[model samples]
Target: MSWQYVLELIQNILISQTGIPHMTWGHGIMLLIALFFLYLAVAKGFEPLLLLPIGFGIFLVNFPIVPLMGLNAEGHMNLIEYFYQYGVASEIIPCVIFLGLGAMTDFGPLIANPKMLIIGAGAQLGVFVTYVGVLFFGFTLKEAASVGIIGGADGPTTIYLTAKLAPHLLGANALAAYSYMAMVPLIQPPIMRLMTTPEQRRIKMRQLRPVSAREKLLFPLIGCALIVLLIPMVAPLMGMFMFGNFMRESMMVKRLSDTAQNSLMNIVTIFLGLSVGATMQAEVFLNWKPLLIFGFGLLDFVVCTFGGILTVHIMNLFLKEKINPLIGSAGVSAVPMSARVSHVEGLKADPNNWLMMHAMAPNLAGVIGSAAAAGMMIAMFQ
Candidate 1:
């Protein structure tokens, strides 16, 4: 071959071998964002289970000319695409995660105080509010519903609903849901403080009644039947959630419960985090919709936090033995995190005040409430 032709071939191979020639500013920006997420997950230990894998997924998919997602030339999907399709799009992974959550969760507090269910339902105000708000932004009903669940602060429900309703926005919605969830400690306290007075925070709650094993076992069965009957669309998520809880409470299936809580949960979490992160490909994520989703997500969390506290205030006006409004803030479904925040704030006001069990009631309720909201939204699409 001629030297000139050989040099041209060498240049072409060099260009083809590396992503640098094809990388754009969007890719650069997204890579930096992924790195930041990694820093948060690794350095700051912020939601490391989800964030670390998600950050790495973003890093992988953003590389130019890659086929980390989508179909290849032969029309078959790559590895991550398969993971996304079956794990998320098929809606199996989220349900599995719920099973794990149920296995790990202690629903005794919620069983002891059924009234907390109202606070959970009340926190869903942000879901509907954001649903209406996103309509003005030109998102269709399904898309709006998917985006609004970010307010409920339940990441799996958000993903499951988004996958069913608006798969196109899955990457953005999942990222937004999880990112906001990680920041619950920061996002909730301000609104919680602003809405409640010193007296409300200092209000000492009565000790939660010790729940019987029978009540614990019956809760998932009755709760599942009631919720599913009311909102069947949530059957998969709720059914799995209750089943896991049942396994834990049943006392006959200790081995299964342990596997669900530890081994199975850990496996699904890794898949979920990686697939979710892979969705943040630069072209799909670096758009106005993601920004809008992020903005709406923040608003949803704020409004939900407000709604929970407001529900508490409204309830206190009527109840003889009042609840501390701070516990209501835990109704946003960030699970133990939001509940812990409420407990910390309560301690700040009164060192003797212990609201963990009380806050747990609403926190557990928030899980059901978010799943119900998801069901309602999914019904709209159906």
Candidate 2:
């Protein structure tokens, strides 16, 4: 009860809590950055589903080394690190997301116009371009491959490929991919406008033929066979994606398809986000490499968007029918988001313009294209 006792107790507590003393100004900076992302996810509604968990993970992992991300003094992986290992490092979470995506997607649009496949492949120019560009920055081929995938704008593919080729850079690549995806509406529009005139944006094509259920069911089988045969490395993600689509098209496993689309997808997304965020410790994330990755990511997106539009122009030169160039911008794998951006831009050019279904073709194809790109990256390292 004496003053001496109180002072001694306070000294003991401060000495025991290592995190309190070991914390540096860098920790504060990272924490603030995490808070800003939280604001974007919560208040600004920027990819809230992933950003919210990712922001919290960043906050938790940077708190002066409290056994969150890596091996402890006992030489065992910590809790969050386990999630990163089993869920992402093992490539389970990304494949699960693809399964959900396949269940939700309708291949009708891409099926009706098989040419959209080429546009999706064209958009991958950003991936290859950035891959070669990052090598000039002294990155290893594997590291550059991981970084280049940010151009694809497919977070799962980015995570999957980075985990295989450059696990260390997974945090930056995932963040860049998701950030650009969330900003698709903003990053794509100016590029779309600059690449194509108002007349090109307003161009309309004839209505697409309605695809039959039999065709939908057959498409997944054929797609799976061809894609897997070409890129055996893509079997995990692509196989799951095709299986999910088959489930939806089959109409026989409605309950399983529902679970894949809704319940399982929701669960994996939370774990995936947190694991990704946990990788962003101050020591690892606050570096020149991450900064460079961000720069390249922006360039990748701009170039990819440009490539898609350019492909459309080239195709129009040879075809009897002209398609709206805006749909080409959907070739980045942001799913309906990139597609929706193209649709909104089309509407702005001409209110009567409806490009949603048309844009879905390239949007859907981008998913496959990105997966194939990821497989190629994995093959390079293997």
Candidate 3:
């Protein structure tokens, strides 16, 4: 071959094999966004477990001509696409994550104070309200439902519902849910303080009654039955959750429980995060819809926090022993983080006032409430 022909062949090889020739402004922006997420996860310690894998996935898939999130020439699904299709789109990973959460959860606080269930349900006010609000902004019923559930602060439920109803919006919804969840410490405290007085924050609750092992073991069965009867659409997610909890409470299957809580959970989490982040391809994510979702998500969370505190004030009018309004903010299903925020806020108000156990009642209740709300929406739309 002539030297000129060889030079042209080498240039063709570089263009085909490297992303540089195919890169666009969109890819550049997405890469920078991925790096920002990585920095947050690594340096700022913001939801490191999920954000790290998600950020990496975003980085990998954004490279032009990469097979990470698409089908190959032979039509075989690429790596992240396989994970997205089978694990996330098929609605398996989120339920599996719930199983792990159930395995690690302690339901004693919720069982001891069943009334906290109202606060949990109350916190979902934003879900329905935002549902109505978003429809005015031109989102369809399914998309609005998916967006509204972000208020619950339950990442798995958000993923689960969005995958079922509006799979196109999954990445934005999941990111919004987790981002707000990670910021629970910052987002919730101010609302809690503004909603309650010093005396209300200082209100000390009585110690929860001791729970018998029999009660613990029976709870999952009873809770599952009631939830399924009420909203059968949620059977898959709730079934796995209660089954995992049953295994934990039984003490007869310690190995299974441990595996669910640690190994299986971690494995599913990696796939889930990566799959989610891969969906944020610049063309899909950098749009007005995702921006609106993010905006409504923050409003939904704020209103949910406000609703929870408001519910407490209303309940106290009839409650013989008043609850600390601060615990109401824990009614969003960020789990122990929101509960701890309540405890810390209480401690600030009264150094001797301990609210962790009490806050847990509403926190755990929020998990159930959010799942139930997801079930309700599925039933309505599906």
Candidate 4:
């Protein structure tokens, strides 16, 4: 071959062999943002397991010339987009995550205090309230619904509903969902304090009535049927949640159930984190939408927290017994974080009162209620 031709061929090969391609100002900025998240995750201990990987993924995808995210003219999808299309868009990831969540969760608290279900429903006020906020921002109904879902405080439910309705906003929505989750300690305490006085916060909760194994056994099956029949669109998310819980409760598939709750979940979480971070490439991350998404998410969390507190207060007016309003803060649906914060806040008010079990009632209810709300968004959009 001629020397010139040989040199040209070598250059092409090098370009193709290395993941690096090009760089831009936007990518550089995203790299910094990614590092910020990493710092928060590592030093601050803010959702480290999730945020650390997410920050790393963002860094990898934004690096100069890296083909990790497939942003070239050829437009071949990288691993992130592949999962986004097959698992996320197809609505598989959320359901799988739910399966894992169900395996990890204990429904004893919720089942024991079924009356707490109302607080869970009330907590969903943020979803609808934020829907109006998004609408005012000029988003169409579908987009508004997508933004509003950040209030649900459940990551899988956010993804599940957004994938079904507004696929383009998935990255922003996912980030919002997780970011708000990490902020539960910061977001909930002020609201919890503001919503109730010292006396109310000091009120101790009654010990939960024992829930029979029979009640636990029937709950998943009946809840599955009830939620799905009522809102068929939400069935995928809700059904998976119930099915996983049933597998755990029934004692029939101990091995499968254990795998779902532990091994499978860890594996999926890694993939989900990396994939989500990859989507946060600079051009995508540095936008007004992300800010709006984050803001709406915070607003949603605040709304849910107070909604639960107020609901408990209202319920107390008619009922003979009074429920501690602090427990209502757990209705934000961030699993144990909101519940833990509720517990910690309660201890600060009164060291003698242990409200962990009480908060759990609303915490678990938020999970189901969020899924139900997500399902409603899906149905309306579909």
Candidate 5:
């Protein structure tokens, strides 16, 4: 081959074999977005466990021709696609995550104060409201349902519902849910303060009654039966959750509970984050729908927080004793984080006032309520 022929051959190889020549503005924008998420995960410590892997997955799939997210020439799924198919698309990973969550959860506070269940239901106001609001914005019933659950602040439920109803919107919905969950400390306090008075914040709740071991063990069985009988569509998620909790409460299955809470949970979370992030490839994710989903997600969360506090005010009007309205914000179910925010805000209002245990009642109730809401929507659509 002559010099010109050799050079032409080299150029052809470079163009065909490498991703650089095919990179587009969309890929660059996705890369920047991925890096921003990485910064939030690493430097800012926002949901780092999920965000780190998710950010990295975004970085990996945005390259022009990475063999990571789609199918290969033989038609088998690529690496992340396997995770997505079996784990997310099959709706297994989210339910597994719920099992882990249940294993780690304590229902004592909710059991001691069953009235807190109403706060959990009340917190769902935003879910239904957003569902209606998004319809006017052109989201279909299924898509709106998937988007609205972000208010619940339950990442797995968001993923589960989105995967079931609107798999196309999974990346946007999951990121929105987890992003808000990580920012619960930032988002909830202002709403809490704005909705409650100084006296309301200072309202001290009596300590919860100590629940018996039998009661704790029986709760999961009874709760699971009631929820499943009422909303069988949620059986996979709720059943696993209650089963995990049952194992924990049994005290006879320490090994199984520990594995579910720690090892099993961690393993699935990695797959879940990566699978979700990979779905955000430039061609798929850089769109108007995702932006709308993000906006609606924030509104939903705020309204849910507002609804929770309002529920408390309504309850206090009827109760002889008062509830600290700060705990109402914890009804969004960001777990101990939202509950802790309530506790901290309570301390700011009254140094001696402790609302952690009280806040936990609605916090845990929000978990169940969110799931029930998801079940309701699934039933309606299916």
Candidate 6:
């Protein structure tokens, strides 16, 4: 090797030679996205439990060539592949999270007032509507289904379906769904306020008929079996969800149930959030599709809210009971938040209207209704 030849070889290796591959500028842009997500998760208080970890994961993956998430000799990412193999692929995380949800949830409100179940079901119209909308926008049938369910604003179902139908969109879709859920307060009230009159909001209903403990214990299992028989694909989500509730109400496996309700479930959520977040990197993430999907997600949430209120008015034509329309808003199953929003709105309408307990029926029904809707999507798409 002559000195001149050696110098030329070193220069060729150090700099980009003609037609050789090099890192693109996409990565730099992705880093900025990571920071933005982090800011939203932290200072903005946007689904912080899920988003904070996800933002950290995005930052970690884009830091050049760490391969913290990359494949093994078998050609799969250590974290993603492992979870898919054991976490998502096994269909464990969704079920595990359901256990936590079931343990934490109360069914008295829902069972006491069954008609609110209709509101929850009505809210789910957005899920299917968005599915059709996404397809019109050029996403494939499966991709559209995955994107549309983000509107349902149910985190586990979002993850469950995306993992089965649109794995590539998993990170973006999960992030969008949870983020939109956190934004419910900001996104909902204006639309809800406009849709109803102050007088309509002031309409109060009778107190809920109290539900028995036995009815509470029976509802989950019976609902699970009936729903699963109707749509088997959602079994992973619905079955485990009901099973968890059954476990909690059964009062038999205190240790096992407690583990599922608390420690085991919490640990899995942290892993699921981080692992999902890690999948986002600039090289793979910079595009118009995710932004469009996110916009559609917002539209879906708004439509679902409207659907609930509209249903109440339509039903009012037939039913004599003067149910507060605010309770209908809680039918989206945002759990405590959506329920609380109904309470707040009712208080604003009239200081005497204590719609929280009454709203609880619709709020709890929203959980089952959302799960059933999620199950339907899974069956249709899967």
For each candidate, what is the lDDT?
0.93, 0.92, 0.94, 0.84, 0.94, 0.79
- Determine which window of 10 residues in candidate 6 has minimal summed lDDT: 15-24
Q: Runs in model 2 with CA error above 4 Å? A: 1-10
- The clash numbers for all candidates, in the given order, read 0, 0, 0, 4, 0, 2
Candidate 5: deviation at residue 271, Å?
Answer: 0.5
If scored against the real structure, what TM-score would every candidate get? 0.97, 0.97, 0.98, 0.92, 0.98, 0.91
Can you tell me which runs of candidate 1 are displaced by over 4 Å? none
Which scores better on TM-score, 2 or 5? Answer: 5
Write one digit per residue (lDDT tens) for candidate 3, span 281-346. Answer: 988888789889989999999989988899999999999999999999999999999999999999
Query: What digit string (tens of lDDT, one per residue) describes model 5 on residues 1-382?
Result: 7999999999998998899899999999999999999999999999998988889889999999889987999998999999999999999999999999999988999999999999999999999999998999999999999999999999999999999999999999988998989999999999999998898899989989999999999999999999999999999999999999999999999999999999999999999999999999999999899999999999999999999999999999999988889999988989989999999999999999999999999999999999999999999998
Tens-place lDDT per residue, model 4, 298-367, is 8988988888889989998997778889988888899898889989998999999899999988999999
Task: List model 1 lDDT by residue over 154-229, tens digit each.
Answer: 9899999999999989878888888899899999999999998898899998888899999999999999999999
Question: RMSD, each candidate, Å?
Answer: 1.2, 1.6, 0.9, 2.5, 0.9, 3.3
Distance (Å) between predicted and true CA of 91, model 4? Answer: 1.5
Candidate 5 local Cα displacement, residue 307, angstroms: 0.7
Candidate 4: Cα lDDT at 144: 86
* Model 5 residue 158 CA deviation in Å: 0.2
Which portions of model 4 miss their true places by more than 4 Å?
A: 1-21, 70-76
Evaluation by lDDT, superior candidate among 3 and 4:
3
